[model samples]
Every structure is written in C-alpha cells, then in structure tokens.
Target: MFTHVDAIAGQLGRGLLLTLAMTALAFTGAVAVGLVVAVLRICPVAPLRAFGAGYVTVFRNIPLLVLLVLFVFGLPDLGLLYPLFATVSTAMALYWAAFVCEVVRSGVRAVPRGQAEAARALGLGFGQCLRHVILPQAVRPMVQPLGSIFIGCALSTSLAAAVGVAELTGQAEFLTLRYDQPLTSFALTTVVYVALTLTSGLVAGRVERKVAVVR
Candidate 1:
C-alpha cells in the first residue's frame, strides 16, 4: 500500500498543481467580475442595477456542473470554442462570480451610511468615493468571505474532471481504477483537499486579525 502511494505520488502532485493553477486563475477572474457586478448592483443607474441583479440571479442559481456541460459540450456547435481547461475555468469563474458579488456587496453595505453621505457631502462622485473611501474600509470585512470563496472555488476545480481535464480528483479516479485501490487513492485526495481548505482558513484568519477594526 505504501509503495503504491509512493509510485503514484508524482502523478498526484501534477494533478494537484493543475488544480491549484485553475483555482487561482478562476478565482482571480471571479473576483474581477464579481467586483464589477457588485458596483453595478449598487450604482445609481437603474438599468445597471437591474443587469447586476439579473446576473447574480442567473449564475447563482445554476448548478456548476450544468454550466460546465453548457460550456464544454454546448458551445462548440455555435462556433464558440475553448480548450478544455480554459472552458472549465470560465465556467468556474462565472459560477463563483455570483457568490463573490454578494459577499462584496454585503461588505459594502456594512459600511456606515455616514461614510458614503460624508463623501458625497464633500462633492465626491460615486466612483471616487467608492474607490478611495468605501472600498478600502469594506475590504477589511471582505477578507474572510473572499477567502471562503477561494476555498469553494478550489473544491469546484474537481468538477473539471467530468470534462476530462485530469485535475486532482480525475487523477485520483485514474489511480483508483488502475490499482484497484479506491481507499488509498481517495484517502490521499481527501487529505490534500483538507490541507488546502485549512490553509485557506488560516490565511483568512491572519488577514482578518491584521485588519481588525479598532473600534
């Protein structure tokens, strides 16, 4: 059993790397889109607000696997195409973006109304106030939620295996079948995931402490 573990370690490491890479890229994209949508959700313009609300409603409600299928299997016939990993990453970003948007919006809303009022009183436009005042304060509260989103996004990368991206879970599946060692293969995979999530939690905790509101 131990020898089998050693033999498969390299393959599992590569899969882990792929999972990490996809999660990092997808989470970055998710944050960017989420931030934009969140701004739209709060902006004064009604149409932009409606578009933001609709986007959150649509993506937040869709199952990630369904989104994956639509991107991987449903898009090519319409002449839109992407590499397997790229397709999966896009789906993950779009799906996770909804959650990220809500987290950010909530953080923004948590700021005292006086802050925005004061900024506006000084003749600062919405964008200027948000960029310099609202967002900096909002970010301290956002660290943990954003970190949770990152961990969730990391787990979601496993779904890429369904479309043949050969990420962590996919490699575990391959090893399980190849060696008839489901217990060993999956135990290893589970440990890796636990480690990843725990690390995320620890980092979030540290950041939260560092940015703790003095009041």
Candidate 2:
C-alpha cells in the first residue's frame, strides 16, 4: 500500500505539471478565441455576427470528449501531426472557447445601450468605444463567471487522460493498476482535484471582491 506511494507521488507530480501546462495554454487560447467570437457576435456586420453565432452553437453543442478524440485520432490523418500534449491542449482550448464566447457575449450584452450611445456622442469610433468604454464596464460584472470558467478549464484537464496525455486522472489510474489499490489511488486523486477546484474558486472570489470594491 504505502510502498507504491513514492511511485504514485512521482506520477502525480508529472500529472499535475502536465495539467498546469495544458490549463495555461488552454486558458490563453480560450480567452483569445472567445474575445474574438464575442466581438464578432456583437459586431455591426450581420454576416460576421451570424458566423459567430454558428460557431458558438456548433462547438457548444458538441461533446468535449468527442472533440478530443477527433483531435487526437483524426488530425494525424489530415497531415497535422500533434503530440499527445499538444493535441489535448488544443482540443481543450477549442472546446472551452465556446463556453467562454457565450460568457463574454452575455457580459457584452449586460452593458447598457446608453454607454455605447454616449461613447458615440463623444466622437469615439466603434472600435474605440468597445476597447475603451464598453468592454471594461461589461467585464467587471463577469469576473465571477469568468473565474468559474477558469476552474472549469482546470477541471477539464482531467479529460486529457482519455487522449493518453497522462494528466492527474491518468496518473491515478496508472497507480491503481500498479498497486492494485483502486480505492486509495482514486481517493487521493479526488481529494487533490477538489482542493485545486476549491482553491480556484476562493482566489476568484477574492479577485471579484477586489474588483467590486474598486467599482
């Protein structure tokens, strides 16, 4: 039982490291993609707005696991050879971007119409109004939800295991196999996951409160 602890510990560390790296890459990509989609959804161009809506609908409706499998298995057939880590990270980012786009779109819609009108009255162009006036105010109220998104991305890292990326869940599974102690291995994994998620929520709450106070 305890004999496998050292091996489990090493594997867990590697898993955590991979999860962190994937989360970082996915978070950045999701935010960037979401921002673009959000902007497109609200843009004056009807075609672009429609395209954005279509993208969000399609991606959000598809299962993340399906997308991951496709990225891992299908992409290589299309001459896109991605390593396990890269494939997992990219798929997670794309999958999460849909949710982020919806979150940001809601945030954008929450802004008062008068704000945009005022910006226009002040001779601000469309881009300037969005950049300087609209998004800043709109984003404040979305801090908590966006924090939730971050936590979700962190949790979603576990799905990397399905694609052979060896994240926390994968490591735990391996340990269970090696030690023949499924209960102990899985219990530890569950505890660690809960801790990480709870920590993310707490940190997000702090940041949300700080922003609220400043406002």
Candidate 3:
C-alpha cells in the first residue's frame, strides 16, 4: 500500500514540476494580456474600450474546461496544431487574463482623479502620466489582489490534466488508478497543493507588506 507511494514518487515529482511550469508560463502570459486589456478598457478611445470589455466578457464567461476542450480538439482541425503544453498554457492564460484585466482596471481606477488632473497640469501626456504617476500609485493596492489572482491561476493549471498534460492532478489520478489507493494518492496530492498555495500566500503577504503605502 505505502509502497505505491514510493513507487510513484518520481512520477509525481515530475508532475509537480510540470504544474509549476504551466502556472508560471500561463500567469506570465495572463499578466501581459491583462495589462494590455486593462489599458484598452481605460483608453480615451471608445472602440478600444468596447473591444476590451468584449474580450473580458467573452473569456471570463466561458468555462475553462469548455475553452480547453475547444482549443485542444477544435484548433487541430483548422491546421493550428500546437504542443499539448502550449495549448493548455495559452488557454489558461486567455481564461485568466480577463480576471487579471479587471483587477488591474480596478487598481488603476482606485487612484484619485485629481492625480490625472495634476499630471495634465504638469504637461504630462496621458501615457506619461499613466506610466510615471498613476501606475505607481495604483500598484500598491493591486499587490494583494494580483497575488490572489496568481494563486488562482496556479490552481487552475490542474485543469490541463483533462487534456493529458500530465501535470500534478493527472499524475495523482494515474497513481490512484494504478494502486487502487485513492485515499493515499489523493491525500498526498492535496497536501502538495495546499503547501504550494500556502507558500504563495505567505510570499504575497510579505510582498504586500513590503510595498505597502504608508499613507
């Protein structure tokens, strides 16, 4: 019984690494796409704002499983073949980007209106003001929210297992089936996930405290 744990340890270790890789890649992509979408949502141009809102609405409303299935199976038919890892990571990124965009937009809006006015009075262009003034202030409040988003993104990487990415969840399931010890297999998996999230939360809390605005 316990021997199965030892036997599957190496495979599970690899799966854990893959999960981390997927989380890092997907979260990075999410942040990049989210920043762009957030900017568009707040742009002076109406069309850009509409497009951004549409993007967030579409992605956030779709279930991750549905989106992953569609991309993994459907895209291949269109001659857009990608590696399983790439496809899963991209889908996860697109899905989480909407939430990230909202978090960023809220952070930006939290800055005082007078701040923008002051920047304008100082002859700063809109972009310059946003980059040099608004964003700096906005980032402080956003740290905790962004951290939560990162944790959520990390957890969502498990969904990639449905498409056979062989991440942590997939490996856990494999061990369960192979050993017929669901409790042992899943309990260990749960511990690993819990440890990961708890560690992330602690780091985020530390970072938040470090960057906290004194005001």
Candidate 4:
C-alpha cells in the first residue's frame, strides 16, 4: 500500500486537474447563458420572456446524464461531433445553466422595487439601472447559492466518467480496474470529494458572512 502511494498521488493529481478544467469550463458557460436568460426572463418583451421561461422549463426538467449521453453518442450521427470531454462539459454547462438562470432571476427579483424606480427617476435607462444599481445589490445575496452551484458542478464532474471524459472519478475507476484495488481507489476518491465539498462550504460561508455584514 505504501509503495503504491506515489502512483496513486500521480493519478489523483491528473484527476484533480481534469476536474478543475471541467468545472471552470462549465461554470463560465453556465454563467454566460444563465445571465442572459435571467435578463430575458425579466424583460418587457413578451416573446423573449416566454422563450427564456420555456428554455428553463425544458432543460431544468431533463436529467443531466441523459443530456450527456445525447451529446456524446447521439450528436455524432448528426455531424455535430464533439470530443468526449467537450461533450461532457457542454452538456453539464447547458444543464446547469437552467438552474443558474432561475437562481439569478430570483436574485434579480429580490432587488427592491424602489431601487429600480429611483434609478429610473435619476435618468438611468433600463440597462444602466440593471448594470449599475440592480445587479450589484442582487448579486450579494446570491453569493451563497452560487457557491453551492459551484460545488454541485464540481461533484457532477463524476458524470463525465460515463462519457469517457477521464475526470477524477473516471480516473479512479480506471485505476481501480487496472490495479484491482477497488477499495483503495474508491476510498481515496471519497476523501477527495469530501475535501472539495468542504472547501466549497468554507468559501461560501465566508461570502455569506461578508454579505450579511455589508447589508
């Protein structure tokens, strides 16, 4: 067991790097899509609002794994071939975007109505009000929830293994199969996941406290 430590460490390092890459890609894409959808959902235009609502409803209802499979296996026949990691990242991002949209919309709605009215009275246009006044206030309260979303994304990287993405869980499974060390491999994976979750929680807690203080 001691002799295998170096090999295990190397495998874990690779897995961690892959997991981080996936998480960063997913979070960036999700944030972009979610912010746009959230703004559209609150827009005065009926069609845009309806479209945003429909998008959220549809994607939020689908299972992430199903979406992953569709992207990885189904898209090739349609000439939309994606690398395994890219496919997994795209699916996860799209799936997570629906939830992020709802979270951000709720944050936007939580902004006091008076703030928007005051901004308008001060000659701020809709975009200015949102960019300068409304969103700044809304985002503070949303930090904790957004942190949880980040943690969730980190955990969801495990699903990438199903699509042959070679993320943390994927590497762990491969190592276990190769070395016939299921117990050791799984134990290490569990520990790594726990550390990741705990780190997320700590960061979130600090942000939550800071927001409370600022408020």
lDDT of 2 by residue, 24-115 (tens): 99988999998899889989999999999998998888888899888889999999997889888888888788888888878878888998
TM-score of each: 0.96, 0.95, 0.97, 0.93
Report the lDDT tens digits of candidate 3 across residue range 1-215: 66655668887899999999999999999999999999999989999999999999999999999999999999999999999899999999998899999999999998999989999999998789989988888887888888898899989888888888899999989987888878878888888888998998898889877776665
**Candidate 2: residue pairs that collide:** none
Candidate 4: clashing pairs of residues: none
Stretches > 4 Å off in candidate 2:
213-215
Whole-structure CA lDDT of model 1: 0.92
In candidate 3, the residue pairs with backbone N, CA or C atoms under 3 Å apart (3 or more residues apart, or in different chains) clash, namely none
Better of 2 and 4 by lDDT: 4
- Model 1, 1-215: lDDT tens digits are 66766669988999999999999989999999999999999999999999999999999999999999889999898898778888899889988999999999999998999999999999999999999889988988899999989999999899899989998999999998898989988899999999999999999999988986765
lDDT score at residue 106, model 1, on the 0-100 scale? 95
- Per model, state how many residue pairs clash: 0, 0, 0, 0
Q: What is the lDDT of residue 141 in candidate 2?
A: 72
lDDT of 4 at 12: 87
Candidate number with greatest lDDT = 1
- The positional error of residue 93 in candidate 3, measured at the CA in angstroms, is 0.7
Query: Candidate 4 — worst ten consecutive residues by lDDT sum?
Result: 206-215
lDDT for residue 2 in candidate 4, whole number 0-100: 79
